[model samples]
Target: MTTFHDLRSRRRDLLDDLGELEDAFAEVTAALDEPSNDDEDARAEQRRHRAWLERQRAGLLVVLSETERALLEFGADGWDDP
Candidate 1:
């Protein structure tokens, strides 16, 4: 039974982490495919970051789902976007 503010804060943080992780993954891939690659550290780092991103994304999805459920319980109060 978390408040909307708490859920929103966590969701925002999680989304930001996912964005950073995605950037890291993309950077690693680009470097790995380059002809003059000098960084071998990114392979492992990419794997780790990708895993972390997946976990965070899943958790955030759950939090959003729960938030929607709570909102539903409060009754539909004209949610249609005008």
Candidate 2:
């Protein structure tokens, strides 16, 4: 029995994680775009890191979507219980 409070809390946590990941992704993208003296290895590592962040972001988005759907199903006055 998932409560409204539980869903809201999970949604908030997921949103926070997604926001942080987006920030990191932006930073990595900026680093990659800059004309630095990084070697091939360093560039590869940056790419890998960006890819990993993208994957994590995707997963969080999926979960967030599900959570939103569940919340919607709970109706507008759902928070009255919690």
Can you give the TM-score per candidate against the true fold? Answer: 0.53, 0.90
72, model 1: CA deviation in Å? 0.1
Question: Which ranges in model 2 have alpha carbons more than 4 Å from their true place?
Answer: 77-82
Task: State how far residue 2 of model 2 sits from its true place (Å).
Answer: 1.5
lDDT (Cα atoms) of all candidates against the true structure = 0.61, 0.91
Q: Write down the worst ten-residue block by lDDT for model 2.
A: 73-82
Candidate that scores best on lDDT: 2
- Give the total clashing residue pairs for model 2: 0
- What is the per-residue lDDT of model 2 for residues 1-82, given as tens digits with 9 covering 90 to 100? 9987899999888888999999999999999999999899999999999999999999999999999889888896753233
RMSD of each: 4.2, 2.7
